[model samples]
Target: MYQYDGFDQEFVRQRSAQFRDQVKRRLSGALSEAEFKPLRLMNGVYLELHAYLLRVAIPYGTLSSQQLKRLAMIGRKWDRGYGHFTTRQNIQFNWPKLEDIPDMLDSLAEVEMHAIQTSGACIRNVTADQFSGVAKDEIEDPRPWAEIIRQWSSLHPEFTFLPRKFKVSITGSSEDRAAIKVHDIGLALKKNDHGDIGFEVMVGGGQGRTPMLAQTIRDFLPKSEILPYLEAIMRVYNQFGRRDNKYKARIKILVHETGIEKLRSLVEAEYEALRASFIDLPQAEVSRIQNFFTAPPYQNLEDQEALLNQQAQQNTGFGQWLQANRTGHKQPGYAVVTISLKPIGGIPGDISSDQMDYVADLSERYGFGEIRVTHEQNLVLPDIRQDQLFDLYQDLVSQGLATANAGLISDIISCPGMDYCALATARSIPIAQALSRRFEDITSQQNIGPLKIKISGCINACGHHHVGHIGILGLERKGEEHYQLSLGGHAGFEASIGKIVGPSFKEHQIVDAVETVVQTYLDLRTEDEIFLDTYRRLGDTPFKEALYAAA
Candidate 1:
């Protein structure tokens, strides 16, 4: 985790104080509802159907034990006794009073966390791979660069009022765990033939009413030009991006309207100017920032394959968990573990104070004293030792955090929906919950294989439905909640936009519709093919036929 310096500390303090005065004015009725709306949004406070909602940025999902404890404290003292982790790797408090937000923010600042730029039209938190530094496939640590971007974009005066919200994502590995292709700007760190690390830049990628997989603007951008290059791209988007329609305001629309060649040329020209200006980042500064992300201390341990397999043979539950939760780490003995936020009947990403403390303890005792939040709304202890995995699994199991359903059907990415959102058109969480209940079996899930089932209450894509392997978008038609389905979408290395399949289904028929689609995939797929693979190979005809065969 990046420690806050004196400047960072002072910045947060002042920002909190500023929001405090704003809240006071709003509460006293000195500020009109019209005047207070934008102010409240700027502070990450929203007026939902039930109460107020506050979103706190996690800075690429890295948190210290103290930080998690602070979140626990906030949840327990101010509002509800829990916080919901969101798909963007952020956490939202559901019942915070309008007046206590400033104080809540003050507590967050104490732990170097805040709700700044979490909502309203600005560059949101820059996300990176959850297993950034520890993942075995990574070429470099992406968080330091993500943090650099976070600092650079924080309250940036120029971009604060862009046509619409902008999102940026970076991944240090080839696997694209951060879903970079579904962001306004996506960056991939890689080493060229000469063994020098640089970035592969993709622009105009995002998910919403109009979802798109960003095109590669620059195949290889040198490490020295990252900031200047990024500045150039954003400048182009800001200047030429549409604003008349909110749906058409994202950079994706700009890249879509103007051909990729023209957009690339514009960005390159802007880059030429920024390279010679204030945005030019020097090598020493980059190294200075990068040094903070040093590897965790670890004792060299040889392969414990025999012991691990033996343990697995004895405990079927442990074996199932190890198969789903444990992933390879770059370090010899360390492994990355995904702590499922979706416990059996629990809310998708809600974590209690005790659970947060338990996670912190596990991170310190078993893995390194570091934790990460995944975009799929889950916690991660990235450097857990293979030797300690069984014990940690037992503890996680006891805490109800060991649901072995990562990338499976039940691990659905869902928004708070009409339950807590002001922009929602339908209730998303209930639909997700119902579907989760319908498909709770691990064997059924594994047999169905790696699938992304994302649902959004509206076209806002808060749940990233556009990228789901099986996408479900809830809409209100004639005062009824109807769901529209999409197939073959992906967000990883081979990103693609999903195609819609005909008419919307009634609320009760949605689960059956999705099951029908799954059955279609199972029937059409070759022995080893996944849903996306089969769709890519044969196109949408078969799925469409299966969905509308009786229509």
Candidate 2:
């Protein structure tokens, strides 16, 4: 994890102080609600359905033990005793009083964390692969680049107010864990034939009322020129992106309205013009940032294949968790462990303060003293030794964190819905809870295999429903809550938007409707075919027939 230097510390303190005064002014009646709106948003505060929501950025999803402990402390002291991890790799505290947020910001500053850029129409938190440095298939670690972008983009005067909010995601692995295709700017780190590292740049991917996968703008851009290239893209968007309507203000809309070829040419022209003037970080600073993400000290030990096999055979729960939650690591004796936040009938990403402290301790004891927040709303211990898997699993089980359902139907990604967000049309958490309970049987989920069910309360797509294998969107029809389903959406190397299956279902009928789709897949699928593969192979005809004909 990147440690904050004096300058970083000073900058955060100043921002916190400024926001403290701003909050005071608002509370004192010196500013009206309308006046305070933009000010509060700039500091990552939102006036939600019931209370103020404070969103804290976890840049590139990296956190040290100390930072995690501080977050736990903040949750315990200020708002409720829990925080909600979000799809953007951020954390949201939903019940904080307006007056207490300043203190909360000050507390976060003590741990080199802040709420900056977590909201507003500015560049938001930069996200990366949860297993960035440890993934076996990584060409190079992307964290250094992510950190570089964080420093460069934070409070950049030119991009502080763009046409709309922008997001950037990066991944170093051949497998697309970071969902790069759905970001405003997606960077894939790869090496060319000569073995020199660079980025494959894609632009205009997003999900909302309109969903589109990003298109590649540059096949190969030298790693050193990334900053200037990004600047060029932002300049183009800032100049020409729609500003009249908020719905069409995103860069994705600009790319849609202006053809990709024309946009690419404009960006190229801008890049050429800025090539002489744009000052990039020097090699020394780049190396300094890279040093922060070097691999932790690892011991050379044999793999624990035999021991793990023996233990899995002894306990079915352990066996299931081992198969689902563990991922391959670059080190011989290490594994990346994902702690699933979505337990059976539980909220998808809510973690209590105690659980946060427990995870911080486990990170230090079982692996490196670092934790990673995944885009899927899960926590990861990136450097856990393979030999200690059972012990860690037992600890996670005791804390109700070992849900053995990663990448399965039960491991749902859902937004807060009407429960928290004022923008939501219907309840999302209940839908997720019902779905999890519906498929509570571990055997059934495993049989289904590698299914992602993402649910969003509304078309804003906060839950990333557009990319789920089975996507659920909740909408209010007439006076009742209704849910719509989309099938075959994927957020991977072959990313594509899901298609609506049929007319929406009533709230009570949603669970049964989803079950019908699943059963249809199970009945028609060939050997070893997952829901997505079968759907792709045979389109949406069979699933539609099963869902509507039965209705």
Top candidate (lDDT): 2
What is the TM-score of each predicted model, taking all chains together? Answer: 0.97, 0.99
Runs in model 2 lying further than 4 Å from the true structure: none
Candidate 1 contains a number of clashing pairs equal to 0
lDDT of all the models against the reference?
Answer: 0.87, 0.94
Cα deviation of 372, candidate 2, in Å: 0.6
**lDDT score, candidate 1:** 0.87
Give candidate 2's total backbone clashes.
0
Which digits, one per residue and each the tens of the lDDT, describe model 1 over residues 280-315?
656676777788888878889876778889999999
What TM-score does candidate 2 get on C-alpha atoms?
A: 0.99
> What lDDT does candidate 1 reach at residue 318?
83
How far residue 472's Cα lies from its native spot in candidate 1, in Å, is: 0.4
Candidate 1 Cα deviation (angstroms), residue 409? 1.1
